[model samples]
Target: MNKKLTLSLDDQVIRKAKAYAKINNVSISQLVETYLGEVINDDEPKLTGVVAELAGIIPDQEYDKMEYLQNKFS
Candidate 1:
């Protein structure tokens, strides 16, 4: 089941959001709903547990060998 709701947004924000919606092949309303749902029902406790698992595992230390040259060239 779903319900309708209305809200106000700045014109520029709406315009950009619409473009984002189009690029992603979804309606503006859907994008808004997804964003709102994520924010309102955020699982902070679960996220903390995931972060805890990565305690000392520094991701991609191999990138340091390139001296971050990939960013400059690519």
Candidate 2:
């Protein structure tokens, strides 16, 4: 179920948020929803189903994740 939300924010903040949301390929509503969900959920990113399955594929080995990603992409 989705409900309508009305927020009052600074003009500059709204402008920046709109630009940020557009660049990230999501609606401002999604951005707000994600932010609010994280805050309400104590900032833990909980994954489930297919995402959890794929996330667990990598072995729990001592490795630099950023370096691995850089090497993989580069």
For candidate 2, lDDT tens digit of each residue in 1-74?
Answer: 99999999999999999999989999999999998888798857778799988996777888898999999999
Candidate 1 stretches greater than 4 Å from native: 45-74
Provide TM-scores for the models.
0.58, 0.57
- Per-model clash counts, in order, read 0, 0
State residue 53's C-alpha deviation in candidate 1, in Å: 16
Best by TM-score: 1
Q: Indicate the TM-score of model 2.
A: 0.57
